[model samples]
Target chain A: MIKFSNVQLGYGGRPVLNALNFEIQKGDFFGIVGPNGAGKTTLLKAILGLLKPVKGEISFLNIKRGHKKRIGYVPQHASVDEIFPIKVLDMVLMGRYAKMGILKRPKKRDYTIAEEMLKNVGMEGMAEQNYRELSGGQKQRTLIARAMVGEPDTLILDEPVEGMDIQGEIAIMELIKNLHTEFTLTVILVSHDLNIMANYVKTLSIIHNNTLKLGPVDSILNEETMAKVYGAEVKIINISGQKVIISKIK
Target chain B: MNDFLINLEFFKYSIACLVLMALVCSFLSVYIVLKRIVFVSVAVTQISAAGIAIAFIAGLNPTLISLLFTFLGVAIFSIRFTERRLSNESRIGIAFVVSSAAAILLVSKSARGIHEIDDLLYGNILAATPFQIYLMIGIIACIFIVHFLFYKEFTAVTLDFEMARTSGIKARFWELMLYLTIGAAISIGMRTSGNLLITTFLIIPAANGLLIANRMKNVFIIAMTVGIISALTGFYLSYYFDLPTSPCIVATLFLILCLTLPFRFFYRKS
Candidate 1:
């Protein structure tokens, strides 16, 4: 479980997140949806202790400097440096750094776990290939495997499916669903695609004007909320038993 | 050829000194070339030269004066750029021009024999003392240790600083480490190769290494090897031909670079 109480985040001069309070229960697949500059990335950074919250406190369950072996992260496509000439396996093994520390090399057990995680993502074959040579979807899968190899209790993915083709997107979505069930992991995903999120994410958190609306997907997917958050009308409809959203006619 | 080889026996220490200087300089060259910090090397060399000239004028030990001025210059250079947010290129330009001018003026005014000044300018490897040899070894060891201990962080920082910070690696600390390492190397090698000839040792071998090696570890190995060869061969060639040692060493590195070019082109094509 994780808790954020009245958390405020900002750069030196401008505030981005204002007095935001939220709690993420264990084993919940939560998706945050909003337009650009919604503080989605900011929220993740604050949780990771990468940024200092201008105000308030964030606490984690059984999380110490080295004990938070349960948290993993898959950043957006633009986040990773592709120029480093690291192989897919090497990138995944980096997740083992916290456990391995400085002196100890990554053990056989670590490689075994990483290889298994790669296989689970159906990317075991590309383990030896340079990471930069992989396609966008393949890269995402490798990153996911990297996060999974750490055996994290909470996995946070920021727009992991962005810029992928339809097939790639669907594959990633299915992979997330399977990972959630297999690991019983708490997933916090930030996405722009509403329909794909609706299918898998049990809970939806919409951020706008530095405030958040938290509820189940069905309850929160509505025209009024969408207009307020995105400044546009969103029409929600069910087509072939799948939730689809048609934008409002301006 | 046999007679020349027999006569060159007195140059053994010079050859050894060149090899060691090459090792440290070339190892740092990979970063300097990649990051385009070639001018930082130029600036450090000139400022340290100026410090030496000042020491001669003030009746102080050249090595002690050089270290003091080098540290002072390093401090000013590091702090000003960090505070002003100046790019490394611009800082190097400012430091290089100002320091070189100061050195020229100080050397002109100093009451010294032209031979001693020329010896400093063209580097007398035969004159490299035991103390300097130990200093160079110590500095090189420290550089190697720093890079090894923080390999992951340094890799991330060198490739992309912002990502390294977000991924929980401290960037400022590593940047400082890099600056100090470069300063220490320049201070130690300034006496061995002088300001001008040091470039051959630093940039040439590292560039050669980059051309051949794809990985950082391999690059370091290749650089050290290239540097050592340039040093020993260059010194012997100078002794046999009765040429200037600095120019001979520089020409030796330049020849090695030329040799690597054909391989570099082929590697790219493949």
Candidate 2:
């Protein structure tokens, strides 16, 4: 579980998001929906401990002193160097670096876990393939494997389905869903996609206009909320318990 | 061939020195080429040369001043360019040009003649002293040791800086460390190898490795092999043909690069 208490985030003296208070429960599939420059990156950076909160504290509830929160992060874009000629399995195995001792190379156990994660992500056969050679979806899966190989308690994905085709989006989303269930992970997905947030996650958090709203999907999937958050004429309809939002520019 | 054999003993230290310089710079070339920060290499070397010129003008130690200037240059290069006003390439280009002008101006004003400029641009490798060889051995050893110890950290930061931070690694620190080591390697190599041959050692072999190998370890193997061959074979070719050593080495590397061009067109990425 993670808790943010009165967290104010920004660069310099300008506050991007102010007075944020929320708690993400364990095993919750959470989605954060925001437009560009909506302090989503700032909040994520705070969680990742890259940026310190300006005013308040964000704490991990149950993590012990010695064992910090192992957060598996899949970035918005492929951060792996395309020109490094790094192989698929080797890329995944790098996830163990934080846990490794100084001067340590990847052991057999690390490789085993990496390969198993590759298999879990359905990229077992591509382990030897160069990352530059992989398709977009395959690269995404490899990234997922890289994150999962660290055996993280929380998995944070930024714009997971961005730039993917319809099939890739669906496949990646389903893969993330299964991993969430099987691992009982606390998943935090950040995206600007309202419909995907409505359709997939159990609980959704919306950050807009320097404010944040946290609630269950049904509570947050109303037209008024969508209109206020997105600043547009919006309609929400449920198809067989799946929510879809239609937006029109005024 | 007979003359090459006769002079081999006399030039053994220089040969060993070139090979060592090539080894370290070639390894770093992977990161440089991978990150598309190839310009940083030339820029830092230029700045380091400026530092040496300053040392000659100010009557200070060249090694110390060179390292100071190299570190200063890398610090600027290490700054993450978030602002879109001037791109990283333009910024690095500015550093390159400014440092180049500074080196020339400083050398022009120094008591040492303009031929000192040539010495700075293309070092006298055949005149390398034992102290220089020992210093190179020490620096190369440190480079290799530190790199191996922090291989994952270095790779993680170079590959995905954001993800490295998220994974609890000090991404910024490692990034700065990487730039510093690269600057150090270039400066140390510049003492005898000069800017041209050092830059060649940094990019050519690594570029070839990128062309031929699909795995990171194999890429390093291929690069180190190419670098050593360039040093040894190029030295032989230089002696046999009575040509300049640096160009002979550079030309040999270029020929190898040309030989490896087909790999780039045909080699599979996956």
Maximum-lDDT candidate: 2
lDDT agreement of model 2 with the native = 0.85
Per-residue error for A128 in candidate 2, Å, reads 2.6
Model 1 gets an lDDT of: 0.77
- The candidate scoring highest on TM-score is 2
After superposition, candidate 1 runs with Cα above 4 Å error: A62-66, A77-79, A192-196, A210-214, A219-221, A232-237, A241-250, B1-14, B28-127, B145-183, B194-211, B230-265, B268-270
Q: Give the TM-score of candidate 2.
A: 0.91
Candidate 2 C-alpha lDDT tens digits along B91-179:
99999999899889989876776877887888778877788789888988898888988988888888888888888788888889999
TM-score of 1: 0.76
What is the CAPRI rating of model 1's predicted complex?
incorrect
Q: Tens digits of per-residue lDDT for model 1 on A1-250? A: 7888998887764688888888888899999988898888788788766777889888886566765336777887666755455678877877655556544567899989888889999997888887877899998998888778767788888898999998999999999999999999999999999988888899999888886778899889888888888888888888888898888787
Any runs in candidate 2 off by more than 4 Å, and if so which?
Answer: B79-91, B233-244, B268-270
Instruction: Report, to 2 decimal places, the DockQ of model 2.
Output: 0.59
